[model samples]
Target: MNTSTHYPNAPVAQPVARHTLAVIVDNEPGVLARIAGLFSGRGYNIESLTVSETEHDKHISRITVVTSGTAHIIDQIKAHLDRLVPVHRVVDLTLQGEALERELALVKVVGKGEHRVEAMRLASAFGARTLDASLTSFVFELTGSTEEIERFIKLMTAVGLTEVSRTGIAAMSRGPDAM
Candidate 1:
């Protein structure tokens, strides 16, 4: 005798995908807070967020938010954002084909003698510029993809890495279209 069991009404789980969403809104006080509140209230995680006024004359600001979730969750997030009073537009850059994303980081390393030399060498290899230098410490500025910055910081650990500050990812679609 052979037996098999199956549930006909079982729900299938969708795979989670990372998405980069660009949001356009009025450049006014409390706009950022409202956006953040939306994510916090919904329990959605924001991996990276960057916001700045894109159109000074028009008083429009662009927010780049990197997040991960199932397709349904992403859709819900976008829909909720659209309902917000200040939101003008929301674009999923990840699904919009080719896009360019970059971040800036400032890394400080404290070293002496050979350690300092090694830090300089590694910075040069990573195309980082020395923004400040003293007898015992050096501050390097680097701009690149998130992974590149992480790798550079990891490598610097062996050369007396001390502190770091990073600007979250800024992304935009390629070609002539404006977001």
Candidate 2:
């Protein structure tokens, strides 16, 4: 006779659909490199990455990264990052709680008379500010979600897109909290 445990009412493990990680690290040299290396070395992909000095006196920087992976991979990534020397904290913004995400993009478009006017009009419609202007070129500054920035870029391309630069993404948890 069989005398083994026969409890078959357990739930299966599911993979995480998406994740946003917010990392607080010392604002020192090689910090970004080390973090990036951690991702590349382990074959993880970074959909978006944004970093900036949040506290000047404390010399602390915040890095917001968007990525997708299974549940196991996400835990692995967090544990690995936490073990880094420069990393002060590694938080999974998506799983831990609610957060706000934003990004800034500077889109440069070069066009002739009509296209130039059209580009400006489109940019205005998208709430993008014209940071710079010339007879044949214009630089529009836009800040919003990644989807919004992508929409603006797609529209600008139709009007004669020349170049674009994005400041990645910066995110933080909502409410009375600091992470």
Candidate 3:
């Protein structure tokens, strides 16, 4: 170990920041796939994606996508999404204020005896529920912010985590007005 007292003030390599985009679009087949293709074709990566019908009659759907890029690239993505015929609007929720983000994940763990007991105890601490359970395996349902979910998963991995299925992030402004 070099004991030289030297401290360099070099800037760290900053990865592109993440932004959550909420897209309101006409609910139709192939729309989600199209949007995904647009990102993949352009060498962009989507960290999380969720789509659901917010209104009845299935006329409209909300697509929430979590992605990271430079400011200019993010702006370009917003513009391109807006140009899609089916997309009514694209809102960068991260740029907006006071947004509430939540996600649901099903984490499966397989273990025996103490491992199983420890898993349940840990899951309880995280407020996760057993959606499915057997002697050798358990499927836990957890809902929370991204960080919370990630932490829970990390803990589960050490306790015999088997797999996970996430519903992505659903976010909205927390105010009287709708986004």
Candidate 4:
């Protein structure tokens, strides 16, 4: 009898880490579904997802996915992504030191008097640009790291924040290398 040491069904007890993966894939129909399915079917949660065609002539799209998982799970995810027909390459941007990440957000605040002044002052302090302003409301545009955006939104809430729309993180490796 052969002894088996691997337990496929065993629960994993390991430290989970947040990672950002950039997948280069062909721009085609159903490609996004397949990528999303890979995560959904495996019970992996995608914290943030951004996809855009980086090469128009080549019909290639770059998909940036942020997720949390153990190291083993992350390796498995990368392997699976690499096996996809449309995927050309999978790079773990989190592992690449000094990767740059940024997001854009539009925040709308509704208030008058002190609230309005305070909100504008807060926005100005954060380098948020006023996109629109009226007697009762102002829409501000801000772009920065995710943490910065979160902090700005939280402070806005105290100053009559009414709505916010965000563009998911757009990231890339810094310096001379291209992922």
Candidate 5:
């Protein structure tokens, strides 16, 4: 006689990691909704998402999604996404070495006198362009990494930031490979 115990149902916790995924899909109505639905339905959170038609003739679009999850969850997300009929390819840009990522922001600042001068000077140091300016307010256009944009916004807030509009991150892998 022998006595043995087994606990196969035990769960193991894994550290969460942030990933940037580039998905290529058919450019058609409802595609973006479907992708969003998949994430929502699965209870996954999207930190940032950007989509645009990349190849007009090919009728293909690219979606860049930033999400954080355990390794297992990330793998499952990719697998499920690849199984979607309209999905062409899913590339994990985060795991694919260094990639280029950028975001664009339109910042509007309202100030007078010294505040206005400081705002413009800081903007110049950050390489921000003056898109529109009036006696009391100025609208600047900035393009850079997310961190850079955030830092600029923070600095502007102290001066007189009034409004801001941002285009979510758009990223791609570096080198000769194409996605």
Candidate 6:
């Protein structure tokens, strides 16, 4: 072991920050693959990814991605994505002023008696709707911010949270301008 002295002047790593990116691209084959390839090739991890064709006539699709990295790395990702042939625009929603973000989650809980009552009570408090219910299980539909969904899930774990399915974040700037 080459024991080296620690240097006080060494550079400190920047804090990793999570950001949401709204990518508009041509609704064609291989476009999504290219974007995925870019992230995978760079060894970047995406926390959440949502894609849908927003403009059917214009053949444009919107891709919402949540990722974490240092500020410089985030900037690099935006720049690289802008260069893709099919991509029309890449907007960092988090950096953009006052973006509204929301996610939809379907939470399933299995229980009986008080567990059932408690689940319903919690869901009602969280504004979650009962989508499906049976003799021993129930599926609740909740739409809220990611943090809220997480909190709800955490609380449900003690009651009877069996599974969860989330529709990744969908975000937009508060202004009227299109992204």
Q: Report lDDT (CA) for all predictions.
A: 0.95, 0.89, 0.92, 0.94, 0.95, 0.94
- RMSD to the native, candidate 6? 3.5
lDDT tens digits, residue span 4-92, model 2: 44656556678666789999999999999999999999999999998889999999999888888998899999999999988889899
Estimate the TM-score of every prediction: 0.95, 0.86, 0.88, 0.92, 0.92, 0.92
lDDT of 5: 0.95
Query: lDDT: which is higher, 2 or 5?
Result: 5
Considering TM-score, which of the candidate structures 3 and 6 is the better prediction for this target?
A: 6
**Residue-level lDDT tens digits of model 3 in 19-133:** 9999999999999988998899888999999999988686899999999998888998998899988999899999987589999999999999999999999999999999999
10 residues in a row with least lDDT, candidate 5:
1-10
Higher-lDDT candidate among 2 and 6? 6
| Residues 1-179, model 5: lDDT tens digits | 34353655557679999899999999999999999999999999999899999999999999999999999999999998999999999999989997899999999999999999999999999999999999999999999999999999999999999999998889999999887
Q: Candidate 1's residue-wise lDDT over 58-83, tens digit each?
A: 99999999999999999999999999
lDDT for position 47 in model 2: 90
So what's the TM-score on candidate 5? 0.92
| Candidate 6 clashes between residue pairs 3 or more apart in a chain or in different chains | none
Candidate 2 ranges beyond 4 A from true positions: 1-16
For model 5, state the Cα shift of residue 123 in Å.
0.5
Off by over 4 Å in 4: 1-12
Better of 2 and 4 by TM-score: 4
Model 1 error, position 43 (Å): 0.5
Q: Which structure among the candidates has the greatest TM-score?
A: 1
What's model 2's overall lDDT?
A: 0.89
Pairs of residues clashing in candidate 1 = none
- On lDDT, who's better, 1 or 2? 1
